[model samples]
Target: MSEQRETRQRYNEEFKRQTVKYIQEQTKTVTEIGEELNIPAKTLHSWLAKYRQFEDEPIINTEKVWEQERIIKEQNQQIDDLKEELAILKKAVHIFSNSKK
Candidate 1:
């Protein structure tokens, strides 16, 4: 039997930016805006933080890239070790086969 599938939705950054502008223009409190928009106040606050773009204004600091460079390096080291082990195993197999001659 085929099960029903659900689709999730997300708003683009520009949409959030415009919403912030609308909120500012209406001078709406966060709670009221949240209720009217059917969005959590905290989510609106996050949009306010990241999407604020104005001339001579500080850039938004909302989205920080969370790269795990250290984890990548560790994984590379593991791959190198596995390659070395495979090479050693191949050499051992070669030597034992020649010894039977």
Candidate 2:
């Protein structure tokens, strides 16, 4: 008779940290993130628990994290808006220059 063994997938610390951060962001439920990431909801919940409990201290202040994320998102949006505006201006300049030819 042959012995059977079970194999489990392993995730790195960085991946676990990022997953916990994503969970803290509250953008999606654990079940949703689990489904999207192909990880079990129970596993994600466990990671959240372990990471959140580290040193019995809050990791980087949730308020500050959320605020920084919001600021970054806003800055990204502004950059995207400026890029779109520049493209439009370039197109207008090209059209006007062609008209003068």
Candidate 3:
């Protein structure tokens, strides 16, 4: 019989930070974010606790939040424009198909 050795998964600091930030900003429980991200809930909780110990600061910076919101707004506008274009194309296709028939 061969003995099997299991290697532990290692997460970088940035990943840990982002996971904690998601938990703080998304209004989702730590367990929910952990499950969604495929990370163990206990591990995430420990990471968050460690982060809090190091710095009592908020997870996301105010400027970063504003920038993220602006980017999301711009992306949403682009999506709306694309949807309108798609609708116009659908209308044109319908008109052309009827004319052919």
Candidate 4:
């Protein structure tokens, strides 16, 4: 019915955290939680499965995360320097225009 289509819902981070935790602690069925939260049951299962895998094999790559962040920062710095140069070139164009007048 059009009434169902008109209904809108959005879940916050805290809501999702609580739901996931409840599913883990209570060992309640995903179908049950999903129905209560109005989210698809399969989505809850996927999140639960992912959380279990992450818990079993935690990421121990602090160095890799730092390296990736460093690379991104360097690229951003280079882009900023290029923009400054472009601004200087624009200023030179205006200078030439004034000289012509």
Clashing pairs in 4: none
Stretches of model 4 off by over 4 angstroms after superposition: 1-60
Ranking by lDDT: 2, 3, 1, 4
TM-scores for all candidates: the values are: 0.43, 0.45, 0.45, 0.40
Roughly what TM-score does model 4 have, to 2 decimal places? 0.40
The digit string of per-residue lDDT tens for model 4 on 1-101 reads: 88887784666667666667777666567798788878898878766665543443337699978998999999999999999999999999999999999
- Which candidate tops lDDT? 2
Better model by lDDT: candidate 1 vs candidate 2: 2
Candidate 3 Cα deviation (angstroms), residue 63: 23
lDDT (Cα, tens digit) per residue for candidate 3, span 1-101: 13323456788998787777667676788888888988889998898886644343455789989999999999999999999999999999999999999
Please, what are the lDDT tens digits per residue for candidate 2 over residues 5-101?
A: 3446689999999888777766788999999999999999899978864543456888989999999999999999999999999999999999999
